[model samples]
Target: MSELVVAEGVALELRPARLGSRAAALVLDLILMAVLYEICYQLLRALAGSGASDDTVSALDIVSILLVAVGYPLVCETISSGRSVGKLAAGLRVVRLDGGPERFRHAMVRAMALLFADIGLPITLITGLPVLILLGLPGAVAVACSRQGRRLGDLLAGTIVVRERSETSPGTMPMPPHPELARWATTARVEDVPPGLILAARQLLSRVFELDRTAAAELTEELARQVAEHVSPQPPRGVAPYQYLVAVTAERYRREIGVNDPSNGTYRAYRGPRPGFPGTRTGARSAS
Candidate 1:
């Protein structure tokens, strides 16, 4: 399973396509291309037979071959957002290494290299030296050696083809920004929280806001326990777990922003000595 960490720090699990499925998909696409090529080939011949000039026929043939052989795959993948008929049928899709959808340029680059492997290699083999072996052989070897089955084209394009996987809905908002926590947040330091746990906290906070009252309270408590494992200096006895997470996560956001430019004034920097957080005797900032 391939896991990608998105902007929200949520790790999304994706399934990478294996060799067998890739090969089958390629075969299906090739068959479709062959049918297109044959239709074009026969039409060009029929035109020549119908008293069209030999030069006209020859030119049209070259154009047809180029369009059917090279142009089809390029157009299909780009227009379909990294899916050809074969890829769609095979439940595969192409995406950037960063897990974003591939764009037109990426599709074009991948297709240009694929042209050498799909057409040039076979044509070259018909000759003695197999000149296009440079393209096809290297790409095949790269695919075999790559952990994610990337080929030369995919590497050059900074893309990967993965089996179609379920998508996750991004969180609506993160716990409503906990404005009350901002004062103490300036002094609070979050320790021992894993990134995944942090994401979970964010997700739960967002979801709980939309849940029924009983469900929200129940989920909040359960999620807080999961979050608490990674946090240090637990909240005081009377404080609700959900509220504790709000303060902790809010502090984390402040610190992350403050490191870049403390003068940015994104956080409310209370005057005087730093107040100890919940359960500590240090003078706490008064709520405005």
Candidate 2:
């Protein structure tokens, strides 16, 4: 499982498609491409007739090859958001490094690479049947050697193939933000929070109940102290650090999804003592 931390520190766990599954998907795509090519070939032959010249025959072959090899993948992946027929059937999807949908440039690079490297279309055209043995060798080798099971195109395009489904679910839900802190959360500046700290906070919250009581308290205090340095307008007096973290995280989620402050049109700047600043309470008290 690869952990991709997107904006505002939301962690998305994606499983990289394995070699066997990828190969199976490729085979399925090739079978479909072959069928499509055969159809185009027969249609072209009918149009050209038995007395067709060499130039006409060559043009027909080029059109068929390009349509099946390059056009198929490019059109499919671009329209389907990184899923060709084969990938969709195999429950796989291509995504950018940040867990976002694959764009046109990414799909185009992969399609061209598939045509040139995986299918070896140009080489096959030149060498006749002998080059068939080497077809797909580059993609297979690259996938096998890549830690993320990515082919050459994936490396160039900054994309990775991941399973469409995830096997693991969040084990526990963190505490909800304190009701008193709701107003503060609506306008908190959480964009500056480091991804590492957010990930740590999420992990801590998930496992907090499982840890030794003394250890959990100590960790909560230490992590809250670090987090406070980045967040402003420390929670009102007596609000626990855990509650503070939950509130900040909620605010971050709200911001990430482009939800603006519903109550008021503008975000008023915070004037209260920011957490961890001089003259402010530690704000790390354990929640009851």
Candidate 3:
């Protein structure tokens, strides 16, 4: 698992794609490329037979090869945020070393390295013949040698392939420290909170235990303070900041799913607060 520190010092654990999965995705992509190339070749032939100029036919042929063989990965990755058809099928994604989305330049460099050095498609196009030589071996070797399973293109582009899907479902609901806090949360107005802040708080809470105790406490306090600014009936006194944050998050989740309006009978998995908090107190007493 690779640990990536995102905004607000929240660290996320991402698993790198395995070699076998990467190879399978690559093979699938190569097969699709072959099919596309064949279609383009046929179209070009049809144009040539229709009395098209030799210069036009030859230029079109080069363009076809470059577009179908060399441009496939570049366009797909750039548009889909580092997911090609094969990668999407295989549940793999290309992300930067810091777990950010890959940019167009990263995709371009990777595609050039892949076609010229790894698969040798550009060389085959230039020679006007298929190269039976080591196609895909160089990239495979680079991935095998690298500890993080980085191929040549990935190394050049500052990207790494990671598994996007998890084996188990995640529980995203946050629970307040005390049951009575739920009552306060249900009545408290929370319509003014920014969506980004809520998302950040959720991420921070999910990985709270993995962080250092002191750092986690500080971050939670800071985030909770920010959340309080947008909430009404300011969090009750004698309660830790995280408890208030949890109550707000849980209330938001409940409202989002219409749990308050209807009896859906849907079960939710709520994560309780982390250890080390003091014992729970009585009713939601307002802060002075």
Candidate 4:
């Protein structure tokens, strides 16, 4: 349940694949690869035909064998957008650390590094301390301890294996209220803002307080535009873009949490900023 913040400021909680699931996927892939290698070996032997010249064995047959051993997962994962038969079965997928789809290069790096660590099949047979040591040593050890849950290959490839989840599952900041924005926050229907925009809003809200004053204004404006695309009715005239964003966020929070707005006691829970703390209200300066 750890979240990753991408460059665009979208926060997503990517469920890293467990070591057990990763091992299972590796085993399943190995079995398939071994079966494939056996079939290829048989075919090559037949073509080399017991007495065939060394030239054919050295050239075409060796190349074909190598291709089968390395090509299967590489091609499958790259073409399938980071999914293999084994990964599909294990409910896992390889994705960039930035939370984008894995590209061919990402797949290739992981595949090649895995070829070294796994030696194609060794990761399954070579269990116990060695495998963990292999992955948990160096850059991987500390990173693994972090939220990412990356292995050596994942580190080298700048990728990680994660179980996909709906974007809204890992919630963001609770509904912080604003007196000026509360009216709109209570009535807005943001349940349909789509996961991507919701993530953007959450990220903006969470990070806005940390940004430089002018930069924060620009950032919030851009984020507000993104959120407004999916939200309806728009903010009333003179509402600052940031206020619009907070209202939408609170509305989404209410929908997901089933909380009643204390005033009227319904699901529309938009109230003032914290009791004594002086925030919001006067900060909104945006015009229509």
Quick one: best lDDT, which candidate? 3
lDDT of each: 0.60, 0.69, 0.71, 0.64
TM-score per prediction, in order, is 0.50, 0.57, 0.60, 0.52
* Candidate 1: clashing residue pairs, number: 0
Model 4 deviation from the true structure expressed as Cα RMSD, one decimal place: 8.2
lDDT per residue as tens, model 3, 1-288: 655554456765566787899989999998999899879978877867877787887788777878886689999999887889999899888877644567799999899888777775666667776566667777888888887788989989988888766411133676433566677776788655544345556677676767777677667777777677778887667667667777777777777656542133233643455554332232332221
Error of 1 at 7 (Å): 6.8
What digit string (tens of lDDT, one per residue) describes model 2 on residues 141-206? 898898788998898888888876442122233444545576777766666554445555766666
Clashing pairs in 3: none
User: Candidate 4's residue-wise lDDT over 1-288, tens digit each?
Assistant: 667765455455556776667667777887887788778877877876888677876775566656665688789888877788888788777777655567788888777666555342354345534544454233344344656667667878888777644445546544555654666666666775644456556766666666666666766677676667666666677677676776787777766777656345343432524332123454465523
Stretch of 10 with least lDDT, candidate 2: 271-280
lDDT of 3 at 72: 91
Looking at model 3, how many pairs of residues clash? 0
Superposed model 3: Cα runs more than 4 Å off: 5-11, 48-60, 120-130, 167-204, 207-271, 274-288
Candidate 1 runs further than 4 Å off: 3-13, 43-59, 117-138, 166-288
**Candidate 1 lDDT tens digits, 207-269:** 444555655555555656665655555554555656666666655654544442223435444
Q: Which candidate tops TM-score? A: 3
What ranking emerges by TM-score with the best candidate at the front? Answer: 3, 2, 4, 1
* Model 4 clashing residue pairs (backbone): 261-269
